[model samples]
Target: MSGHHGLYRPGSSVLHRLPAQVKLVAALLAVLAVVAAPRHQIWVFGCFAAVVGVLVATAGIPPRLMARRLLIEVPFLGFALLLPFVAQGERTEVLGLPLSIEGLWSAWELIATATVGLSLSVLLASTTSLPEILNGLQRLRLPALLVQIMSFMVRYTDVVAGELRRMRIARESRGFEARDIRQWPIVARGAGTLFVRCFERGERVHLAMLARGYEGRMPMGDASGAPWSAWATGLSLPVLFGLLALTARA
Candidate 1:
């Protein structure tokens, strides 16, 4: 499958060569195990991070790219930080402020689980193309209609983004600066216009597809099954997590 403008980094690493379906399933299972693990097992979460770190290293993904992409978790981190303040429970003094001990634990657990899950997603996206990911979903028997909708979304998101960018450029060319509240109306109008244009374009594209015999289902190309070794290697991370979850308290 062709990689496009996303988190996908083209390379011949083992992870990049692994089957998309295997990676998808492994990531899902790993996340479920992370969720199931006891929050008090901080060492188990450290092991999880180590496993992910090894995968990242094996994949040869740049640390800078991973760090930049992880900025998405900043909002969750913010919420986690707030927990110690708003949560009602036993209190402890930290840096001259009274904070809930339970809230601190909760915050740690929240950040740990979220970071681990998001990191797995980032790894998957970095390793697999969007098309391959969608194909994996289809192979997994995701509802055809939902898969088709997601396929369209994956295909046209860039087109929509490009249109929006061009509209922004047009606005800028006309000396429209949205630096102040007074200019909000202009920005809103531009957004509405962009939506209308994109909607019309989508209609035209749909008609074209219909003319070209686009039935309800998309043609997922012939993808072969993963080898046993590939499955074992891909599943090792989740298997480790499951074992850790089972013995976390011990």
Candidate 2:
């Protein structure tokens, strides 16, 4: 419920106003359409990116925040870049380096698809609160156990992170600087201590919840209602993407 919790940006944009379930489905559909699209038709991926870009703009997401979140894709981008060098196929020269022709095409497709997919996910998370997302999944008939697990993970991740941070500060205060490999054992022990503390904290939390009348599942309050207009507005982009993908396949 904190103002800065997770990736939920405070805004009144139409994207922010849409029901969480609607946004979830819209994102899923858009990702599926991106995956379904033929790899050779690179223009289709461009169109997909354009659509997601417009939505991100409409959502009023800050470029800095988006850029920071997009850092998650750096590893995937690196792998894609390497494809041109390692993949076996017809060879071509670029900047005096011989590369596979097929690898170039494959890399392009990988980068494009990854960008679109990750963007859609980032957009969804940026607009929807973690609690709202969990509620939305419950409404969407996602498995009860799976939803519950996700809910707990989201709730405790911050606590675990705080514990780790405090441990780091304590180490720094004691003048224990991890400057080299010799200090790595100390770092590993710190990590092990953090794990034990997190485990104890989780046990205490579970016991408290049990004593407070928590059953196997957390009580989700009333589901947010989605009107027809909301559904239509939310799904418009995905429908367009789907049609384009189908057209490209045809």
Candidate 3:
């Protein structure tokens, strides 16, 4: 199945060739390493960023596309930017402004960790299709229920969105504009109605799946797991970074 609404860009890069499971696990490890690194070790984050930059370049995704994808970080950036002013700690003056030292460290940590985590996730999505991500989670022995929920969520979110769009178009076509607060109930009721319709559709879909022998699991896909060389190749960066993190603590 094609990716429903994923960021996957087709390519034959080394990342695209690696098994989804390997890439997923390696990305997780990379994010964890970045998160666990000492906040004072700013250089480690730079190293992690460099590694991600290399992957982005190798994947053939344009930098503008990556920068746009990273826009999701804006909300986190706002919160991080607020931390230094609001948090309490030993204060230091920066350009005649008082800032809490601990808060500054916290802000740095938040931005660095969140940026790394989000970038790694974007890398995964850019390289692997949505279905493959679900498959990888299943291979990792993630709870079957959680996996199913995610699978359905990924599959049906578009349906829900389309339903919403249709509803909006219908409403607008009929001159159902909310000109004031008095019309708010109409919008709320429409939203609730949409939910009920979606719920009923989900029930129908579930019954259909059960009719076709869906015995509480999705059919397995290509089981040819990553080769040992792929593991060594895919994990090399994370492992090297892990060692660097360890050495930095020494």
Candidate 4:
């Protein structure tokens, strides 16, 4: 696994030392707090963002890398932007344009909450490896089936991606041009072929695991609970932010 391969950055910072379960719980609570925050108050969101920024810096993650990870929220941001126009409410004029006041608040809340939540998640991902995250989830008492599903999703994501790359290579080699809409059928066919290949690959992987004495529940190599200090260090910032959110809401 290369340093740049996945979200986990190799580091020895305090954030890295803290166990995954603590961080996972802290992040989840903080996100729920953000979702419950008063939408009209910009300061609450700014405070949450500041907390996330501090965590990112402490983990030694690069700003550019975090910026790239934030692209996942862009699609929802488009819908959030549209809310100002499409949603009906009291109009607030800005720059000679009529916009709904309620819509503006709704949009602001959506964008700010999503940005903060994603930043927090990205911070956790940057600090914890996938396997460790799975361990943490199991420790947190999540349903075995849900954990297994997520484990498979994380494990096979790269395999499926590799299969797609091979398919694309074969397509281009066979004189398939997908640069325009005229060749969309070819692209659709390619996608279908990739799905079939992925299903077959899944079957093979399942059988191989069974042959290797695979069971429904995979053992976590190190399932030890995090120390009190780890919990204190991990939960402090989010707890502070959660209090701030409550105060702001009140």
Candidate 5:
């Protein structure tokens, strides 16, 4: 909710210097490649992981930081762990316990897919500033409405979170105890109040935008200074993915 990690840290690394649009496109291609990979192909998953590893290394991001950041997606990863119990599949026995063979395979597939997708997404977010990434999306021909919504959402998320924090602190100052399950109504009311406050804030922000001549589109600076080496590095992802795909198919 803090949205603290959405901004790119200024660095001399090749990734930081790359044009945002190029990086975005390359990230999309990498995601597609990972998605297109066959479920049972362990080698293909390894290849995807290797490509991500190289990118992480090249970008000079710490492995521990990447792992911690990416771990935010683990709730969805839990679905992978659960699939082996609920998924329809051939029956098998392991350690005197019965399980579905197909379910186990499905679980593995889900984990691999989620790991690759989430890792790539986290890398993108970590390396690119939110504004730059949004601008890149606009350049890539995303609809204006979608762009505006994303922009506003990103801009106000921190504000909303700060408001929630202040509200909680104010409540706690008066000896509000959240020790009972039945006291959840207080939390619910607080959340509802926050929603109303966000709405009012949005209205004020809209009026301010109108005063500033914002006609539903935010102006963005041109990204025209990417070096050739950055593009070269970005292009390598697709080539690596293609090679991996071929290897998996073979």
Candidate 6:
């Protein structure tokens, strides 16, 4: 279990150099465009894929890593795959299987929407560091309290997860394997212990924060220098959207 969540991976790509604020805004806009898009528009979906593809390529992320990270969606994707069979609509036979036309179309739309949203999110996260992302949110005028809570959660999630892992390992070493369904209560108790430990750790962290001038707000760092290529790269999505509109309307 690595403790790295939302931490920046150092890279020299244009996306890495773009201001976090700009990337956050662009990501949001892209998401909006995808979500508000016409449901049956294949061209819009193609454009969305193209824009994400360009960003992923520019970010220098390996395709295999991207696929592996995106694998988290497979279970949901499996459900989407089953939709065509279960959904009620006009029936069509494909390879001796009865499939609903409306269901198949609905499934495609859902898959496209999920794919676009997930790809944008992963690309943004992979390119931008967590601290920078928080800074971006702050710049965008997100509520101070919400930002603070999110920052702390991202920072401490790994710590909590590590604690849980160690507890599990200790239990396993003691030959405490559950041999019956009735032993679930023991597992529940272990979970309760983990919660208490995490709560104690949070209190200690709060004390540590108090010792260090404990301001409710995070201090903004020096302004980051933006490179020339960032502007061009940032606008790529809009350009892609324009092209998509043209094709879709035609």
- Compare the candidates by lDDT and give the number of the best one: 1
Candidate 3 lDDT over 1-250, as tens digits, reads: 4574568898899988888889988988877777778888888888888888998999888999999999998987999998999999799999999999999999999998898889889988998877777778887788879988888888888888899989989999999987999999989988999989989998999899999988887765665666899999989867977876776677
Q: Which ten residues in a row have the lowest lDDT in candidate 3?
A: 217-226
- After aligning candidate 5 to the native by TM-score, how far in Å is the CA of 73 from where it should be? 3.2
Q: Whole-model Cα lDDT per candidate?
A: 0.89, 0.87, 0.85, 0.85, 0.79, 0.79
Candidate 5: residue 119 Cα off by (Å)? 1.0
- Name the regions of candidate 2 deviating beyond 4 angstroms: 1-3
Better of 2 and 6 by TM-score: 2
Q: After superposition, how far is residue 91 of candidate 5 from its true place, in Å?
A: 3.7
Q: Estimate each model's TM-score.
A: 0.93, 0.90, 0.90, 0.88, 0.85, 0.86
Lowest summed lDDT over 10 consecutive residues: which window, candidate 1? 1-10
Model 2 TM-score is: 0.90
Which parts of model 6 have CA positions greater than 4 angstroms off? 1-8, 178-180, 223-235, 242-250
Residue 200 accuracy (lDDT) in model 6: 92
Error of 1 at 119 (Å): 1.1
TM-score of model 6 (CA atoms)? 0.86
Better candidate by TM-score, 2 or 4: 2
Q: Largest TM-score belongs to which candidate?
A: 1
lDDT of 5 by residue, 78-98 (tens): 887777778786878889767
Over 4 Å off in model 4, which ranges?
Answer: 1-5, 179-185
Q: How accurate is candidate 1 locally (lDDT)?
A: 0.89
Candidate 1 vs candidate 5, lDDT winner: 1
Mind giving the per-residue lDDT tens digits that candidate 2 earns over 102-161? 999999988888888998898888888777787888889999899888877777788788
Q: What are the RMSD figures for all models against the true structure?
A: 1.8, 2.0, 2.1, 2.4, 3.0, 3.1
lDDT of 1 by residue, 95-185 (tens): 9999999999999999999999999999999989887887788777888788888888777888888989998999899988889999999
Q: How does model 3 score by TM-score?
A: 0.90
TM-score for candidate 1, please give it. Answer: 0.93
Write down the RMSD of candidate 4 (Cα, Å).
2.4
lDDT of 6 by residue, 18-121 (tens): 88878887787777667767777787788789868877898888888888778778999999999999999799999999999999988898888888888888
